[model samples]
Target: MVFEVIGPIFLLLALGYLSVRLNLLNKEQVGTIGGFVIKIALPALFFQSLSSKDLHQIWYPGYFFVYTSVTFLLFGIAYWLMSTHFKNTMSQSAVLSLGAGMSNTGLIGTAVLSLLIGQKAMTYTSLVVIIESVLLIPTVLILVQLGMQQKANVAEIVKKTAFTLFKNPLFAGVMLGIIFAIFQIRLPHQISHVLLMLGQTASPLALFAIGGGIVGMSLKYVNAQSFYLVFSSNLVMPLLVYLGLRYFTDVSQEMLHAGTIIASLPMPTIFAILGQAYGLNEKTLTPLLMSTILGFIVSGTLISIWWA
Candidate 1:
C-alpha cells in the first residue's frame, strides 16, 4: 500500500528532474509551473475539498491547537539550539527554525495524504494548510525580520503579516470553503466542474515541480545545521505530535495518523524561496529540503505502514 501510494509520486518527480537535466525544462519555466500550482491549482483544490465536506467535521479545533502547539515548540527549540549552541546568528537561526517548524503540507503532503487516506483526509489536510499559513509561516517571518535587525515597527509588521495571510490564496480558499460549507451554498454544476478540473492538477504538477526544483541542489551543502533541521522536521516534530495525541487527547486513530503523516512531510519548498527573499543561505536550505524530501520516501512509507 505504501509503495502503491508513493511510487507514482516519486516517479513523476524523477521525470521532472530528468526533464530539467535534459534541458527539457529550464529553471524559469519550472518556477512558472510551480507558481501556477501554488497560486491557482492548490487553491482550487483546497476550496473544493473543504466545501465538499461538512465544516463541523473538517474544523478540528483540538487537532489544530495541538498541531500548532507542537510546531511552535519545535520552532522555539530549533532557534535556541541554533543560536545558543551552534553560535549561528539570529537570522540564520530564524531561517533554520522556519525549516524545522514548517512541513511541506501544501505540496508533497496534499499529494501523499490524499492518495493514502483519500478526500476525507484531505479535508483535514486543508485545515492543516490553514493553520500553517495563517499562523506558523507568519510567525516565522516575523522572527526572521526581527533577527535581521530590520528597523520596522512591530505594529506595522503585525498588520502586514495579518494582511499577507488574508491575501494568501490557500488561506482564502479554505476560508471561503468554510463559509460556503457553513452556509450550505452550492455552486452551479459548471462552476464546480471547472474547479474540480483545476483542483485535480494540483498534486501531480506540485510533485513534479518539487522534483524539478531539487534538480540543481547539490548534496555537498549538507552540514550539521542542515542535518539538525532535518532531524527536527522529520523525526522530532512528528514524534511530538504522535505522543501528544496519544497522551493528551482522545482523537480518533485516523486523525492521529493524518496529523503524524502531515508532520512527517519534508520541509516546505517555501523555505528556500523565503531564504532567498530574506538573504539567508540557499545552499543550506536547498540541500536540506532535498534531503528531507528524499528521506521522506523511507520515513513516510514506514509511517503509512504503521498507521495502516
Candidate 2:
C-alpha cells in the first residue's frame, strides 16, 4: 500500500528532475508552468472540491479549530527557535517558520488524501487550504514585511497583506466554492465540466512542477538550520497533531487521520514564491523546501501505515 501510494508520486518527480537536467524544460518555462498550476489549476480544483460537497455534512468546526491552532502554534515555535538558536534574522525566521508550518496540501496533500481516503477527504483538505491561505499566510506575510522593515506600522502591514491576499486566485476559489456550497448552487454543466478539466491537471502538474523547481535549485546552501527546519515540519508537526487528536480531541477518526497526513506534507510550493517576494535568502529556502519534499515521502508513508 505504501509503494502503491508513493511510487507514482516519486516517478513524476523524477521525470520533472530529468526534464530540467536534460534541458527538455528550462527554469523560466518551469516557473510559467508552476504559476499556472498555482493560479489556475489549483483554484479550479479547490472550487470543484468544495462546491461538490454539502457543507453541513462535512463541515467540522472542531477539526478546523484544532488544525489551525496547531498550525499556528508550530509556526510560532519555529519562528522563535530559528530566531534565537540559529540567530537568523526576523525575515529569515519568518520564512523558515512558514516552511515548517505550511504543508503542501494543495498538491501533495490533495493527491495523497484522495488516493488513500477518497473524494470526501478532498473536502476536508479544502478546509485546511482555506485556513492556511486566509489566516496563516497573511500573518506570516505581515511578519515577513515587518522583518524586512518594509511596513512601518501594524495597520499598514495588515492593509497590504489583506490587499495581496484578496488578489490571490487560490483564496478567491475557496471562498467562491464555500459560497456555492452554502447556497446549494449548482454550476452549469458546461462550466463545471471546464473546471473539472482544469482541476484534473492540478495534482500531476503540481507534483511535476515541484520536481522541476527542485531540480532548478542548488543544494549547496543546505546547512544544519535547513535540516532542523525540515525535521520540524516533516516529523515534529505531524507527530504532535496525531498525538493531540488521538488523546485530546473528540474529532472523528477520519479527521484525525486527515489532520495527521496533511500536517505531514512537505512545505507548500508557494513558500518559495513568498520567500522571493519577501526578500528571503533563496539559497537557504530552496534547500529547505527540497529536503522537506524528499523527507515527507518517507514520513508520510510511515504515518499512513501507522494510522492505518
Candidate 3:
C-alpha cells in the first residue's frame, strides 16, 4: 500500500531528474517552475488539504505548538554546534541551519504521510508543513538577514520580515489556505475542481525543480566535513526528534511517527534558494546537494522498513 502511493511520486521525480540532465530545462526555468508551484499550485493544494479535513479530527493547536517548538529546539542546538566548528558567518550559519533543519515538507512529506496514515491523519502532517513554511523558514530567513547584516534593529527586522512573508508567493498561499480553512467555506464546485486540477501540479513541479537544480551541481566540493555536516542534520536530527518525542509525549503513534518521518527527510533546496537570494557563497550548495541525495535514499529505506 505504501509503495502503491509512493510509486507515482518516485516516477515524477525521476522524470524531473532526466529532464534536467537532458538539458530540457535550465536552472532559471526550473526556478521559475518552483515559483509557480509556490505561488499557484502549492497554495491551492494547501487550501484543498486544509479544507478537506474535519477540524475536530485534528489536534491543530496542540500539534502545531508541539511540532513547531520541538523543531526549533532541535534545529537551534544543531545550528549552534555546526557554527562553532564550521565557523560559518552568522548569515551563512543561519542559512545552513535553515537548509539543514527544514525538511522538504511539500514535496515528499505530504505524499509519504498520506500513504502511510491516510487522509484523516494527514492534518497532523499538514500542521508540520504549515509550521515549516509559514513559521520556521521565515524566522530562519530573518535571522540570516540579521546575522548577515549584523545591523538591523528589532523594528526594522520585524518590518522586513513582515514584508517578506506577505510578499512571498509561497507564504501568501499558506495564509489564504488558512483563512479559507478557518471560515469553513469551501470553494464553489467549479472553483474547487479547478483548484484540484491545478493543485496536482505542485508535487511534480517541486520535485522537478529539485532535479533541475541538481543537474548542474558537482560533487567535487563535498568533503569529509561537509559530508559529516549533512549526515548530522539528515540523520541525527531525525533520531533526536524520534527518541525525544517517543518517551516524552503521549501523542498518537501516527503523530509520533510523523515527527520521525519529517526529521528524517532531506533538507529542502530552499537552503540554496536563501543562499542565492542573500548572495551567500555557492559552496554551501555542495552540502545541500549531497545531503539531499543522501537524505532521500536514507528516508526511503527507513520509511519502507517502518511501513513493512
Candidate 4:
C-alpha cells in the first residue's frame, strides 16, 4: 500500500535521469521542463487548489506559528555557524544557510503530501507556501543582499524583495487563490477546468526535472558540509518542527504529520541557482542531491510508520 503511493514517484524520477543518460533528453530540454513546471504548472496547481478552499480551512494559527518559528530559528543557527565557525563570507554563509533552513515544498512537498493525505494536502501546502513567500525567502534575500553588496540599503532591499515576491508568478497565483477563497468568488467552470488540467501536470514534471538535474551533479562536491546540510534539512529541521508542535500545540494529528513531511523536503532547486550565481556552485549541488535522496527516504518512512 505504501509503495502504491511511493513507487510511481521514484520511477518517474529514475526515468527522467535515464532519459538524460541515454541522450533522449539533454540538459537544456530538462531545464525547459523545470521552467514549465515552475512558471506555469505549479502556479496553476496552487491557484486551483487554494481557490477551492475556505480561508478558515487553510489558516491555522498554531500550525503557521510553529512552522515559521522553527524554520527561521534553524536558519539563524545555520547563519551563525557559517559566519562564526566556518568563517565564510556573508554571501556564502547566506547561500549555505538556505539549504539548511528551507525545503522544496512547492514541488516535492506538494507532490508527496497530496498523494499521502489526499485533497486537504493543498491547504497545508498553501499555508507553507505563504510562510515561505511572505516571510522566509524575503528574509534570506535581505541577508544575501546585505552580504553581497556592502553599501546596500536595508529598507530598499526589503521593499524590493517584497515587490519581487508579489510579482512572482507562484506568489501571484497563491495570493489570487487566497483572495478568491476569502471572498468566495468562483471562477467560470471552463477557466477552473483549464487551471486543473495545468495543475495535474505539475507533480510528474517536477519530479522528472529534479531527476534530470541530479544527473549533472558531481560526486566531488560531496563533503562534510554536504552531510551537514542533508542532516539539517532531511532530519534536524523536521524533527524540531514535529517535536515543537507535538508537545506545544493543539494542532490535529494529521496537521502535525503534514507539517513534518513538508519540513523534510530537500533543498529547493533555487538554492543551487542562488549558490551558482553567488559562486557556491559545488557547495549547493552536492547537498541538494543528497537531501533529495534522504529527504524522500525520511518522509517515506514517516508516512509508513503513521499510515501503513
TM-score against truth, every candidate? 0.93, 0.90, 0.86, 0.96
lDDT of 4 by residue, 120-185 (tens): 888888888888888888888888899888699999999999898988888888889999999988
Task: Report lDDT (CA) for all predictions.
Answer: 0.79, 0.78, 0.69, 0.86
**Of 1 and 2, which scores higher on TM-score?**
1
lDDT of 3 by residue, 238-277 (tens): 7766776677667777677777777677777677667778
CA displacement after TM-score superposition, residue 211 of candidate 4 (Å): 1.2
lDDT of 3: 0.69
Record all residue pairs in model 4 with backbone atoms less than 3 Å apart, i.e. clashing.
none
**Ten contiguous residues with the weakest lDDT in model 3:** 53-62
* Among all candidates shown, the one with the greatest lDDT: 4
Deviation in Å, model 4, residue 202 alpha carbon: 0.7
Which residue runs of candidate 2 sit more than 4 Å off their true CA positions?
286-290, 303-308
State, as a TM-score between 0 and 1, how close model 3 is to the true structure: 0.86
Which should have the higher lDDT, number 3 or number 4?
Answer: 4
**Which residue runs of candidate 4 sit more than 4 Å off their true CA positions?**
none
Model 4 RMSD to the real structure? 1.2
Arranged by lDDT with the best first, the candidates are: 4, 1, 2, 3
Q: Clashing pairs in model 2? A: none
